[model samples]
Target: MDKDLERFVEYCKIDTQSNDTSDATPSEAKELNLTKLLYKQLKEMGLEAEIDQYGRLYSKLPGEKGLDVIGLNSHVDTALEVSGKNVKPQLISSYEGGVIKLNDEYSMSPSDFPRLKNYIGSDLIVTSGDTLLGGDDKAGVSIIMEVISYYVSHPEEKHHPIAILFTPDEEIGRGPEHFDAKKFGADYAYTVDGADVDMIEDENFNAAHADIVIEGVSIHPGEAKGKMINALRLCNEFDASLDPDAKPEYTSGREGFNHLMAMNGTAEKASMHYIIRNHDMDLLQKQKDEFVSIKHRLEAKYPKAKINLDIVDDYKNMHEVFLKDPRAVEHADEVFASLGITARHEPIRGGTDGATFSFNGCPTPNLGTGSYNHHGRFEYLSVKDYRKMIEIVKAIVKA
Candidate 1:
């Protein structure tokens, strides 16, 4: 087995699904499992690696003087939207291009996800039907690990100072909450957290998380004529008021969305969690305002009920910061071109830790690791693109 693929498979088996409700940096203790593994591996390879109190792992590879310090980053935690536990990776030596039956309950089909056709002859790493493969960022982590392993074996090929950061809770938008830019000491960085092998992402959604709580008066059905204010019904009403056409399933390609991530409550109290996203800040704010407006409308309609809406700013589009200093993207494009790959610049509909890193003083752009259908059971990685990502990392550092 390829060492990188082996690392990815090993990491995927450990459950590292982040908890959005947790205030801790890692959000879950299980993330430390992977953190410890990465830290131990880096140290064994003679690199200066350590895990912070917050479960953020930093590994440094020393290089010649006068070269700009570069950082390679990837998240350790998988998305909380799906089960990342007990992941059994199924390896396809060579894809023949058709529906891949993960199990009787689920399958990955080219007709459903057209991009599967892109990797016809390449090897694939997929998950069993019951869980996600964690390739969303595990693939990225393996690529970084491969680069470090290569440098460890070939010390004479060293070029620039390199820093490796494996973060926790990226799936929950807390990946960079405790990231110490000064400690990492990298002039620029690239997060290997994107989807396509040929694409480089510079822009991401301006994000905000909204929590709506509806408190209503609950009474016996016999005595609840005009006095009953059912919070559950009100919650349904609130969700119905939002634009249905602007949801994740309906929107794409620069279109913003108000995604209702979760909802749980009863007649007395109910809560709806939403993630609002847009490329433009002004438009994002407008979307937020719409959420607030809906809350106010609900509150007005149900005078006896209390409706509270809280919107928290998550991360902005990293492209705003990158546009000011585009040397990172330029260097990445040069490296991609050198490897016979065209740099396809695209906007990310979702957020990444790079957005937080870029805003936090390290200009970082997102690079792809041949991952597709992230955060779901259908997720898979292309072995060919995965290996190429390792080479891309080496090229970026050696350049």
Candidate 2:
């Protein structure tokens, strides 16, 4: 087995699912298990590595004088959307290009995901139907570790200084909450947290989170006819007011979305959490304004009810910041072309730590690790594509 694949499977077995409700940097103590492992490995390789109180692992590899310092980053925590515990990885040495039955309850079919056809005869790493594979970023983590190992072994190979960062809670949008760009000492960086081998994302969504709370008047069943205001009903009304076609399921490419992530509560008090995204700042603001407008109109209709809305800015598009200095992405493009890999530039439908790092002055772009069907039971990784990513990283560093 490839060392990177071995490392990936080993890390996936550890449950590091982050918590959004926690106020801590990592949001979960279990994430430190993986962080400690990474820090130990980096130290064993003679690299200067340390894990902070927040579980963010940082390492440095020194280069010869007059070389530019580059940063390589990936998250250690997996998404909370699905289970990441006790992952039993199934490795197919040579895929025959057909439907894969992960377990009794679920199967991955090329018909559902046409991208599977591209990996025919290549090795695939998948998870059991009950949990996610955590390949969304673990593959990235493995790739970086393997690249560092390569350079450490080949002392004759000259390269630039490398700054390695393994962050937690990226799946929860808090990966860079404690990241210090000046301390990282990198002129530019690339986040190896994207999907597919061909994708090299320079743009991402201008993201925000909206929380709506509605207070209603609860009355007795017999007297509820004229006195009661159902907060749950108002929640549905607000959901219906949004453009249904602009949701994640219905939209693609550069289109934006207003995703209602969660809703809970009784008639007396209810809360709805929504995520608004757009590549265009003006359009993102328009969607936010529409949310406020809907809340105001509903408040007027239910005069006896009280409603409160709060919109928080999460991260902006990295392209806006990185475009000013195109060296990072241009270097990646040259690397991909040199390796005979077609470079595909697309706007990331979701936010990445690179967006936060870029806004913090690192001017980071995102690279792919061949993870597919992320944050779900159908997640899988292509071994061939994973190897390509290692080469891509090596080339980027050398560039």
Which candidate's lDDT is highest?
Answer: 2
RMSD to true structure for each model, in Å: 3.3, 2.7
TM-score of each: 0.85, 0.89
In terms of lDDT, model 1 sits at: 0.89
Q: Candidate 1, which segments miss by more than 4 Å at Cα?
A: 20-25, 98-107, 211-245, 260-273, 291-309
State the lDDT of candidate 2 residue by residue for 186-303, as single tens digits. 8899899988787889999999999999999999878898899999988999899988888999999999999999999998899999999999999999999999899889988989
Q: What lDDT does candidate 1 reach at residue 352?
A: 76
- Alpha-carbon local distance difference test for all models: 0.89, 0.89
Clash numbers, per candidate? 0, 0
**Candidate 1 per-residue C-alpha lDDT over 86-171 given as tens digits, one digit per residue, 9 for 90 to 100:** 89999988899989999999988999989888889889999889999999789898889989889889988967889889999888
| Model 1, position 264: C-alpha lDDT score | 94
